[model samples]
Target: MTPPLLTLEGVELGVGGRRFCENLHWSVSPGECWGVLGPNGAGKSTLLHALAGLRPVEAGTIRLQGTPIETLSRRAVARSVGILFQDQEYPFPATVLETVRAGRYPHRPFWSGESAEDQRLALTALWETGLEGFDARRVESLSGGERRRMEAATLLVQSPRVWLLDEPTNHLDLGHQIALLELLLRKSRGQQGAMILVVHDINLAARFCDRFLFLFGSGESCQGTGEEMLQEALLTRLFRHPMRAAHFGEARCWMPL
Candidate 1:
């Protein structure tokens, strides 16, 4: 069996001193896309933050590629894991190139600018995300979907072994959503890396993810292949809705409640 690329044991997090989740344990293997499902306030985003080392772990261990996340330096972590948060706030007026260039900060110093190799990487990422021609465009002027793709491109430039995406489908149109998910799957599969996405859309999650994790009050109750785990009873209980599932071609899609 392949060792897990990332593992969380007894992990816990909180906000305003309130525990979000406790005693959480999960493992993700290379080339697997794991969708995290939970109701509002279930700490899905918090879990991603913990994996990315953006927030300190209060209780347990997060090991990335066999090393304890806590022991890794911030720069080392940045180099090993790339995160696309739900909220990507860019306060400065930066062009698309500039914004994506920031992804290289871990490798480049603040005083110096990007080198030729860095520009090549940034452009390669932008090209992959379909923003190749918009290098000079201001990030603020792009549509929500475009911005999301750009953010994805930025993370790609980091070339991490594990990609942490928080609600990546948010605000995207149907076409863009499908396109982005497909692109991510293709890229991660090629790299033999892992992608852990925090998603609320059950149908989308079912369609894209190879495996799924369902979170309840405090921690995940189940995780397995989508076909094995996305049962009607589980969906209804997880979302508190009378939901159903149907086979569409080779995939399972969640029916409207």
Candidate 2:
């Protein structure tokens, strides 16, 4: 069998003195899309950071392609794994195209510059993310939604085997949200890559994700398909609110009751 794209074995994560989840074992394989769902302060972002090697794991191991992630160099990790945080900023003045082109750095030599193909790919990524004519726009001047899409475009340009995204739907309008998720789904299917995203919208998670990791914010967690895990009682307990599961055609949705 092919090794998983990413794996966590006996992992523990926390902040201050509070434990988020302990003894966590999970793996993401190619062609899979996993959603991380929980209430605020549930350590969803922290978990994504830990997987991306931005934060240290309290205990246990994280492996990429069957090798310990810590053993890999930063560039190697970047080439294999990509992350999109909830908040992104461009302090320096740069065009959207320039920002997206930066993703190609991992594939180029230290002394080399962006190639024509890289530029082409960057343009394609921008177009796919609904920013076709925004290539020349200043990154700092773009609106929040535009900037979010620009970040998504940059990640598309990177094209790593594993994608770790924190609230990818942030700042997106409903139409853009659907478009972006559809684009990501298409990318995962086409490239046979894996995606793990932190999402607060249970409905959206149900629509796009095949697997879910639920953090109960009490050092307890669970993982499984939405059909197996979307029980009203479990969700109500997890979020500390009454919830009703509804089905609209073939899509399952959760609404607060």
Candidate 3:
């Protein structure tokens, strides 16, 4: 079996006096895409933050490539793990290309400006995200969906081995949503790549993710393949509602009753 790229052992966290996750043991391996599923305030985003080392866990260890994440320098972590935040904000005025180019910060020295290779990578990422002609567009002038796609482009330029994405599809239309997820799925399956995304779309997760992790927001959680976690009873209990299952050919779907 292939080794894991990232591992979480005995991880626990809580927010606003509510305990959400406890004793979380999970691992992400190369070429694997894992879906983080939960209701609101279930610590899905919180867990991703912990994995990225941006937020501290209440307890437990997070390892990247078998090394304790805490021991790695911020630059080291940034070089290996790239996070796509749910909310995208551009505090300073810049063009779309300039913004995407910033994602290469970890690869170059602090005094170094954008390199030619970096520019090429940024352009390639923009084209892949369907933002080919957006190079000169002002960041603030773009719509929310366009900005989200731009963020995806930035992550591509970052070129990290592991991706931690929070609501990667927010503000996207149906076609754009599918396109972005397909792109992300491709990235996660690329060379030595892994991904874990916090998403509210159950069908999208089921379609794209081979592995599933469910957080109950009561310090209880579960993880497994889709076949083990996609049952009506599990999802019904998970969402605190009655869920009816359907099949579109061999694809399983769920609807709240």
Off by over 4 Å in 2: none
RMSD of 1: 1.9
Candidate 1 lDDT, 76-139, residue by residue in tens: 8998788888988777688999888788888876588789888999999999888989899999
Q: After superposition, how far is residue 138 of candidate 2 from its true place, in Å?
A: 0.5
Reference-based TM-score, model 3: 0.97
* Residue pairs of candidate 2 with colliding backbone atoms: none
Ranking by TM-score: 3, 2, 1
* TM-score of candidate 2 on Cα atoms, chains taken together: 0.97
Where does candidate 3 stray beyond 4 Å?
Answer: none
Cα shift from native, residue 49, model 3 (Å): 0.5
Return the clash pairs for model 1, or none.
none
Ten-residue segment with the worst summed lDDT in candidate 1? 214-223
lDDT values of the candidates? 0.84, 0.89, 0.90
Which residue pairs show collisions in model 3?
Answer: none
Model 3 local distance difference test score:
0.90
Candidate 2 lDDT, 1-257, residue by residue in tens? 66798999999999998889999999899988898988899999999888887888999999999888889888888888889999976678999999999999888888989999999999999999989999999998999999999998889988888888899999999999989988977886688789997988888888888898999887799999877788899889889999997888976678999
